[model samples]
Target: MHGHGNVPGMDAASEVGVDVRWSETLRTYHAVSNELEHELQAGHGLGLSDFELLKALCRCCAPDKGTVLMKDLEAEMYLSQSAFSRTVTRLEKAGFVERAACGFDRRSNFLAITDAGSERYLSAAETHRAVLDKHFG
Candidate 1:
């Protein structure tokens, strides 16, 4: 039965195919994520989440100021608030980013990429692209 006999509207063969595809997808994701994590950590001292947050901030930051609202960035991130906050805290500790209170909204905070962060991001980005290209390109 392969555990698919109970699945309604799906034939055994289709169920097996789906399972194989799902397994492959999981394997690929883990492989790529592991590689990225390794390279990023060795090359930039950053994890995947750290690199991603920096990249996103660099992309969405105000052109002149390199700043964005925490709420807005949080909305874009797929992580839970606590996870996002932890990442932010790590970056802030590393001097990669800064946190500021929003003047207009007391409840809102702004994140700004520091000069050091930009440099790290630029360097890490090259490593990131190379790893992905090596795997997929």
Candidate 2:
């Protein structure tokens, strides 16, 4: 009990609703993340972060400008810059994305998804959506 009220089965820490809610949120996130990682890898040969990076780029792809700069995508990604860069490198090696120097900026680089990436993303998206629907629908 939190010393505020008695919760039948919980100790002081877990007795409070706020504490329970926070823990449940963390639990749900982990469950979803683990499943996503597993299914993406098993079915698509892609990691969860890899799928997410591809998803972000695909969503933000402009009709005129299919490329998006790292800075522009920084907000969409949950990883640190170094981690994101590493993901990009892995995707590039897998032939899913291309990293190119910006035409007008020396220090800026942009990412463009390949045709293969688009096709892969199309297949993986169904898996991603199915998982989300099962968990949160």
Candidate 3:
């Protein structure tokens, strides 16, 4: 449809749709994030980003071995210092995440996912998996 030479059902836009791939990827990620967040909100009563942060922290084996440093969370979550701080604050408010001074590095702080946080993560993860199956499968 873009030009005269374009064949039926083979318009230039149809043939070359890669321009929107980046946007599509971002949109998909956002949709998935929102879906998981909605499930958590309904079932576990936790915010989206806070649930995600707790899940990430729990993945660091904090539950078994204890705590993970704040810097480690920032690096793993790829969040800016201010944004990450805000997330941690929200988590702390929700009783899912907590921060403490790193014993080894006094200047650095540590993050821990609490029991409630772990349970919430597991429940949200199951819901997330079901949503993925419903949408992607």
Candidate 4:
């Protein structure tokens, strides 16, 4: 009888509070993502996903082996398979990333960051970090 609609363990006031919190969190996330997307696109002609892929590739690069396997790259991505593939294709077309057939596994492809990609990532990283620092720091 104390709860909303006479439901047990559920109250109108508590439900409203939870909904408000969830909405606020989502709104904040979207706002931050939008700001980053705008800044990156304006400064480097790269979208947030593009920048993330390039940065991941750079981190995965080794001195002797500069490429990361497609499977490995997929693990680091937040996008769906189709979306990730599309972004990769776009970056490849832009000459920022190159894909090579894996010598060991015919079914696997390796993705490597080109010199241009590295340069672009490094430039955009500064701006990305600055924005994060401003908002979260």
**Best candidate per TM-score, number?**
1
Per-residue lDDT value at 69 in model 3: 84
The regions of model 3 sitting more than 4 angstroms off are 1-15
Model 2: CA > 4 A from native: 1-15
lDDT string for model 1 (16-56, tens) is 79889999999989999999999999988999999999999
lDDT per residue, candidate 2, 51-130, as tens digits? Answer: 99999999887967779998887679999999998999999999999988998998999999999998998899999999
lDDT of 4: 0.88
Top lDDT: which candidate number? 1
- The residue-level lDDT of candidate 1 at 35 comes to 98
How much lDDT does each candidate structure score?
0.93, 0.89, 0.77, 0.88
- Assess every candidate by TM-score: 0.89, 0.87, 0.75, 0.84
Better of 2 and 4 by TM-score: 2
Candidate achieving higher lDDT, 2 or 3 = 2
In what order do the candidates fall by lDDT, top score first? 1, 2, 4, 3
Task: Output the better candidate (1/2) by TM-score.
Answer: 1
Tens-place lDDT digits, model 3, residues 16-100:
6764887788898898778877887897777666666776787775556758888887877757889889989988888877788
Candidate 4's TM-score: 0.84
Q: What is the C-alpha RMSD of each candidate to the true structure, in Å?
A: 2.1, 3.9, 4.3, 2.8
- The ten-residue window of minimal lDDT in model 2 covers 1-10
The sequence of per-residue lDDT tens digits that candidate 4 reaches over residues 1-137 is: 44447664647778879889999999988988999999999999999999999888888778677798977887898989888899999999999999999998999899988888888889999999988887789
